[model samples]
Target: MEPIIIDGTAKTPTVKFDSTTGVMEIKGRSIPENSIEFYKPMVDWLDEYAKSSKDQTVVNVQLEYFNTSSSKCILDVFKKLEAINKGGSKVLINWYYEEDDEDMLEAGEDYESIIRVPFKMIEIVE
Candidate 1:
């Protein structure tokens, strides 16, 4: 599958999905006008990748802020990962947050509690 790379904008985060190196990362702020539109292809690609994936899938997410709609999109991403995990593929999620951002850390913990996949919360000391 082709990589998904979107340049970061004021209200939208960058998405980089590199199938070659087995590293998929999403970083930056997220508050897009149309959250579903921005995340549709990404979800589709992930769905496709999950079908034929042999290597472990690692998703790294680092965001400064996101809107409510973006939160839904993120949950969708995790749901996809959960499906992949149930399909017998190894899935790992690393949620990176600033040291003092307890809100983000709590959000990560919430996701970790709900999702069956392996989710790791990482502190990024700035």
Candidate 2:
């Protein structure tokens, strides 16, 4: 399947979804003007990827900041991954945050509590 590679803008996050390695990485800020527009393609890509997914799918999310709209979009992405996990394949979400970013860590923990997939919170040291 074709991968989703979106370079980050001032208001958006960098998205790199590679089906070959089964690693979907999203980094940088995610406060886009239109969260649905910004995230729909990636969500659609996941729909396609789900058909022939790898045995293990890992999602790495590293965001410094994101607005409420973006947060919903992010949850949509995670929900898709949760479905994949429920389908018998393993799906892991790695939530990366700076060591001092308590809000980011809490956000990840929030998702972990709501989502079905396993999440690994990684603290990035500057």
lDDT by residue for model 1 (45-97), tens = 88987878656888899999988899899899889889988885788999999
TM-score of each: 0.94, 0.97
Q: What are the per-residue Cα lDDT tens digits for candidate 2 across 1-126?
A: 899999998899999999999999999999977799999998999999989899999999999999999999999999999998988569999999999999999999999999999999999998
Task: Name the candidate that leads on lDDT.
Answer: 2
Model 2: CA > 4 A from native: none
Error (Å) of candidate 2 at residue 94 is 0.4
TM-score of predicted structure 2:
0.97
